[model samples]
Target: MLSREIINLQVGQAGNQVGESFWQDVLAEHGLDQAGIYHGTDPVQLQRVGVYFAEVNHAGSQSKYVPRSLQIDLEAGVCDRVRSGPMGGLFSPETYLHGESGAGNNWAKGFYTEGAELIDPILEVVRKQAEACDVLQGFQVIHSIGGGTGSGLGCLLLTKMREEFPDRMLATFSILPSPKVSETVVEPYNAMLSVHQLVETSDLTICIDNEALYDISIRALKVNSPNFKDLNGLISKVMCGVSTSLRFPGQLNGDLRKLGMNLIPFPRLHFLMPSYAPISDPKTQSYQGTSVPELVQALFDRRNLLVACDPRNGRYLTAATIFRGNVASREAEVAVRELQTRNSNQFVEWIPDNVSVTLVSVPPVGQKQAAVALSNSTSIQELFLRTHETFAAMYKRRAFLHWYTGEGMDVMEFSEAESNSQDLIAEYQQYQEARAGDEDEYDEEEAPSEGFSQ
Candidate 1:
């Protein structure tokens, strides 16, 4: 049972901060408080701690469940805050990976110097956690692709993890930078470069855009100025939904191995846009008990999506919908039937039937039910559009170019990143356009997108 254990590695300020929120969500779900005290274990919740966490044995009985996660930051402030925060005691001091100075939003600084220096120490902790796993399947890197520490060092670790554990799988949960507000003028640089590494090294990378989260925060939570705390909570819910099948036993297609097969048929096109419903938050209270068909339909709504994607325009290459908490197998099948038979659920010409629905009846920690959709759709092209445009605008003007050059990184790296990102945008665009002006029949020239059954 522990053979497929996942080793999570949370990198950078964005990663650690998000990691904090994620842990908070998991703790709440498991009825564990900030003090690590058990609130209640009514039916006994599904704890992934044994797989992704290690217990620090106390006197004779009580033990602290510390995640295999290694929280890293180029600077001290974020890591320091987590080390002293309310939930700080729940974590081990050794898990906080740090360096002398911040990356100043420069990707090269983290990639070349900082990440290179911390590799040995970080791997040591990872080794200890892996040894506990008995059979370490792979890693889940939680980080933003638009920041220095997350983007540069996150990519560095992705490559390093691949080299260190060649047989294991590497998956990333990446946060896309908001289009409007950004701290780094060179966010486009960081995002594109990391995107290249993610495509190359990782088996699957689930992307959640900040634009969608910010909008959800304002509309769903009704927060005037939502901070990372609020946004991270929303992200954590989606993560929980995606991971429920992994944490708890289900019929099929629940574990990390099957999730990869369901989400990523094509190795390169591994970007999955996650959408979950019904949206739950602090301000929001009741779940009106939506019908199965409505639940299925709502799964396609961009409003419920963790990432901002245009579903109306783009084609779905493949999709996997996970229904948890009291959802029956018959319910899921009927819902998918209604969508396909009664309503329009668009799919690409290559795979007309790409949506694989799975029903897992795991008890929810808070919400009564959740429908999480992991879709490999061409709408992801829209995300690349935002990064590409902003990157082009900033790159053409040579904005913040000196910081990278000063770090001893070659200037041509930027061009390479642009070229790779541009290729991605074009590839998705081709996938989207191929469906148009052509019959549903597969063209020999068109790339064959892999598919699987429910």
Candidate 2:
């Protein structure tokens, strides 16, 4: 069977850096080097890995197939550095798009001018990539909401992707700025626009909080000062676990479509929080094998959650537990049945039992077992609360309004976007309240839950 071809469009410095490490993890998973040259000989397995990348050179050319990743940035230095780096051969040189002047952490600069100027060139590259695929399903974008290029240009790209290829999927791996840290004074302003666009566009948007990531690095990896390289590598591992079902077929939910079907019931409730077990880094800490029950329990712990949240307090609309790497089917069923009894972590009674358990025997690299859970929880309400609070504090005083207005963005758009952010938060809050009030009625009806197929 042919694997689904998905293009990866990494925008800005944060995006490219993250994609570099992401492909590293993917190459390792497929038994390939940093340059993406496959080490295996199995015809079927090789093609499966190839599905995720594009062969840059001709059929017989020296340049091997690289991940179909388009590295875009407002500044040229990062691209130049990557081209001269050890893995330069892994990517097509022509795919890098850049400009002389940077976006300067201003969303207006990126969206109105920089991103707009590069749209034609970026689209050209995307068009060529689309032409190469036998069945081009969609593209995945990676960037942060704190900076101009990553937040502003990233949103512009997503908006265009949605407009041009309305039929194809657009999944965004968005890095959320730390609520406590001051990345830039204008970050609050940038995040408001970026997140609003994410909510308006994109099919599946996974919010990876920088705060949560940093916490994990310090606690799990024992890193004194976790740099981008260290943090990105850890995030890449989670992406690998998330992509396992997409790259390899084993049990149910092996395809990207199923991932959306099983997890996303509503469009706006598309915020997915990923949690991967065995959080320890092998270099800093030992790789320990854990029981199915222990792994499942860890996923429930918010400390291991990719998004910073008190999940025990948040309401879950739907959840999926993906147990990969030699996990037994019976063990998976028993684990879910057990996790369900801990209603302290379970869904409200009124809503259907929406916990899904997908058990696949395929193991991740250098490990015998692993588990990742994608939960569509209301904890994102808390997530948005932080962004909105920061944004509102700035917007009320019209702080940094000129940065956007000067770049052709309407001043009112900020308020509108802030309103949009508040609406999603309110929606999640409402859902949490609905099931509780409707619980008695649901109980009287004796309806079957749309939960675990085990």
Candidate 3:
């Protein structure tokens, strides 16, 4: 079978740094060195390498593997650092795009002024990258919604991709802003605006919260002061785990489209929360092999979620659990079924077989087993509710209004975004409170939900 290629777009400072960490792990997993040269003799490692890399041969040099990715930022600092970094040569020089000034943490500059100016060139490069593929699958974007370039321009690119390639899948690893680790004061505004766009543009959105990363680092990894590298490493692991089936041949292989189909029940409610299990500090030497039942329990544990929402608070609409490593299919099936049967109330009763299990033979580099769960639960509304409250607090006073309006944005747009976000939150609430035969009752009226205060 031919490999289905995916193009990766890393936008803004946060996106580029996270992308670097993800590539480092992917290269190691595929047995490729920093210069994209395959040093390992494992043919299985390189069999499906083309999924995320383009095999290239230079004059009189060994075959070099280049990542099918684009590094973009409104400012040149992040891209410059990546180019001069250790894994610099792994990416093509033409794939980097930058501007003179940064986005100043304002969404208007990224989406309208600075980001708008660069969209054409970015799409052109994307077109060239797609032309190099034998079977193009889709595009994955890694970005943060707190900053100007990542939030504004990242969303702008998504809308364009939908227009240019309507049939292709669009997925994102979105770093949402948290009150605990906010870099700027306007993070809520940026996040709300980004979520509004994501609801309309992205096919699949993987939510990652800084607060959750911090909790994992402090509790699981035993880190005192976790930096961006530590947080990005955790995200990279989940990203790899999510793509394990696509990157390697497995009995239960799944792709981006398959994941979306299973996890997403409703079109507008595509936000997914990802959880990874058996996460421990690297300083600890001894790695224990976790059983299938224990692994399933850990995957559902709120402490292990990449986002800071509790699944118990909201019912699960659908879930996809991907296991990587050597494990018996019967064990996995029974474990998941047992879990579902034991906690049937946690899932919506209407959907039959709400939980999906996929197993891949190859494990991570230094682990006996790894499992990642993508859950489309109503509890994700907690995140949206948090951002909406903050945005409302600031928007009521017209704070930071001039910055966006100066960039040719209308004040009405903010209101519209707020309303759209409220509708999304309400829709999730409606389905969450929905029961098996009570679906017709929710179709009566579309009133604002007062229960969102929780």
Q: State which candidate has the highest TM-score.
A: 3
The alpha-carbon RMSD values of the candidates against the true structure, listed in the order shown, are 3.3, 2.6, 5.0
Please give, for residues 39-66, the per-residue lDDT of candidate 3 as tens digits.
9877889999999999889657778899
- Clashing pairs in model 1, backbone N/Cα/C closer than 3 A: none
Instruction: Please give, for residues 1-454, the per-residue lDDT of candidate 1 as tens digits.
Output: 4535887788888788788888887777666677565665643353454655565666577765666678888888888888888888777778888887887777898899877888788888877877777767778899998888898888888888888888787888999886676876678889888887887898888999888888888987788898988888888877877776776666564566677876675778899999978774554557366677778888887788888877877877778888887777766776775565433335664565577777666755666777888889888988888888888898898888888888888878889888888888888877776653367664534433333345
Q: Regarding TM-score, does 1 or 3 come out ahead?
A: 3
Q: Which structure is stronger by TM-score: 1 or 2?
A: 2
Q: Rank the candidates by lDDT, best first.
A: 3, 2, 1
Provide the overall lDDT of each model, using Cα atoms, as 2-decimal numbers: 0.77, 0.80, 0.90
Residue 325, candidate 3: Cα error in Å is 0.8
TM-score order, best first, reads 3, 2, 1
lDDT of 2 by residue, 272-337 (tens): 998889787677335365898898888878989888888877767778888888887777777766
Better of 2 and 3 by TM-score: 3
Q: List the residue pairs that clash in candidate 3.
A: none
- Tell me the lDDT of model 3 at 77: 93
